[model samples]
Target: MNEPLAERVRPKTLEDYISQHHLVGSKGSLTHQIKKGIIPSLILWGPPGTGKTTLANIIAEESKRPFYVLSAINSGVKDIREVIDKAKQSGGLFTSKNPILFIDEIHRFSKSQQDSLLGAVEKGWVTLIGATTENPSFEVIPALLSRCQVYILNAFDKSDLEALLKRAISKDKWLQSKKIVLKETEALLRLSGGDGRKLLNIFELVINSEASDAVIITDQLVLDKVQKNTVLYDKTGEQHYDIVSAFIKSIRGSDPNAAVYWLARMIEGGEDVKFIARRMLIAASEDIGLANPTALVIANSTFQSVSTIGYPEARIILSQCAIYLATSPKSNASYMAIGKAQQKVKETGDLSVPLPLRNALTKLMKDLGYGKDYQYAHDFTNNFVASEYLPEELSGTSFYVPGNNQRENALKTFLKNRWKEKYDF
Candidate 1:
């Protein structure tokens, strides 16, 4: 079978690579390191088709190191060992030019699989290069992550995508023979969603389908071709955003049925259970607030459980959390409180902390009246004391006005009794 356009046109050197100039340009960190022939193990974190793999290849080529590759989806501890053993052989007593081991989709590696790499990476048998679409902090093992520098790769912008298309027409052997005109690219850009590989493939598919040697790439043509080829739900595309929005809104609107339906939609679509749980956790805190504080706890537990369990069983845990959040009493008080507090800070800039509330950890702080007259609420009546806690500029400013609900109402009554109209309860 013929190689795909994405592979055929893959950048073999930094000069051919588009985008990520921050890492590949002159004065770029990686550029300096590569010039010095000293490349560290690193994890490239970014969205799909952002040239993580290409950059890794270029680093190995530029640094003149032996290269090895492994796919986290299929590679296990045994595979890791095999690669390490090969890298050791390739290194051959040369410490300066250690072999470069590139692992695509490194986030998919489980803890044990990741741990197996620690020995080789720590001992410098291979200069590891990992590519991940997910946040490495959450997906990668802490021990392994600490040993590797994490570089962030951004999605291809409009100009970068256009550059890729132009390069393909000018440089590719097959595309060079045909006359292609890009009349419009809104549909292509929107559909590709910043994935360079996907954009090229889509472009190739559209160009190949036309009968004539001349090709006019218009939005309508791109749409017509892509519509028939697009999947119902793409975890990384527009549908992902829309479905997640629907799920959160359903829970906030107190419609358990709608929430569950959307939850099922995500599960069946093979959405990351952790992603689903994370959104529900935000909804619990933002939507359920003081009315049902337990919602946050349950949502947190759901996130932990699903992350640990994964997949089919995780769906059940996510469903339970989603229903609980939908059924719980809804209030945005806590969320509003933070928003209001943030606005106040922006307005006030960096206001000085009230001296009474300041820590007296040092003699200088104590001498400056810090904690000098700070009221000890626990020593006072009802374990409360009216005090000026805010900076002087922010005195009388109430950022956390309780929502009118049973729980917040009780809180209002308690504050009213203790502070005596200070909070205007």
Candidate 2:
């Protein structure tokens, strides 16, 4: 008999788990800790199908400790206490090796439910392993979070997904028995959207639909099988990631029409109107920036309007904001500038603040030439003063490069006239 797809592919050990190399890889901190039999309470924060649950199980098995499981969806304070009692019984009050309590969807747990586990975790009655798709800071109570280390799990990359596919095709007894050929993988990857579980499900759907002994899986075959079934937009589910990707790519490609199409898809899928508005707000500052500064204002206003008025009526407001952002002059100069500056800061370590820019509140600081020779721009011609703000090592470093847009062109002209050789196009 063939095993269930989810069970068949469930990673039994950390070595078998895919993705989240930062947490479970050979040299990963968590892997080292688990190998030494010194597991601590930790929160596994990540999107679905990134092996949070599987990793929890592996930790339990490898530790050879008593294991208890609970779901935030069904477990309550009473349930938590019951598990705690069992854990206490398994390992007495002063016992060092306590049972590991694994809670899935722990973000959904209410305050009281989470609080119930805190004492047990603090006292070492159970090593807590909580899995969540939401940010632990936002969802888990501070008291509970304080007792656990939070490990972030990233979405599986293309290579990880491909490795997963290969494993399923070869390792799964059911799949190995069938003659399957992968002609194209574009549609499968598109449909999976970095979700390991979704990828396997789509693979199963394609393989199961084959009529002949020799089955070939291609983009067309995958599309043909799943095309008839409408993929409803799920604001908090897999659809959310897909539509947002489409929306961002459209804006990046400067296709307003495609951008609006994706916007409409999110709205129709029942996405939180405010959530859509927030993404637009970020895109305005990050993607549009000074190219069209007004894009930020429009996006900010749309966010306000959506918060005040929700649903059917707010959709129009969101659509207007999306269209404006999509059609606006696009530049990532400011974004790139900050990113470069941050990278430089990290690479060079901390550098002392230039004397002129330092605070003069203290007498010692003022005596040391702090705030000395500082020229106020307002006192200079054209409200511009040539001065060095960066450290000595980065005195002449240039970061912001103006894009080819009317606003940026005007900025370039102004800077060139003000600083002469200092400003370059």
Candidate 1 residue-wise lDDT at 133: 88
lDDT of 2 by residue, 1-425 (tens): 46557568788877788877777787787988888768889999888777788889999898888989999999999999999999999873644477999999998788888888888988888999999987788679999998899999898888888888988888888888888888888888878877788788888877778877688888988999988754677564467877898898787677889988998898888886766887888899899999999999999999989988999999889878878888889889999999989999999999999999998998998999999998898997778788988888887677898888889999888877876786455
Give the runs in model 2 whose Cα sits over 4 Å from its true position.
1-3, 18-22, 45-47, 64-128, 132-150, 154-191, 203-242, 252-256, 272-275, 301-314, 346-348, 360-362, 376-385, 409-418
Q: Write the per-residue lDDT of candidate 1 for residues 28-71, one digit (tens) a residue.
A: 76888987779888999988888898898889888899999999
Residue 173 lDDT in model 2? 84
Off by over 4 Å in 1: 25-29, 92-96, 255-257, 307-313, 336-376, 387-399, 421-425
Please provide TM-scores, in order, for all candidate models, with all chains considered together: 0.85, 0.75
Q: What is the lDDT of residue 307 in candidate 2?
A: 80
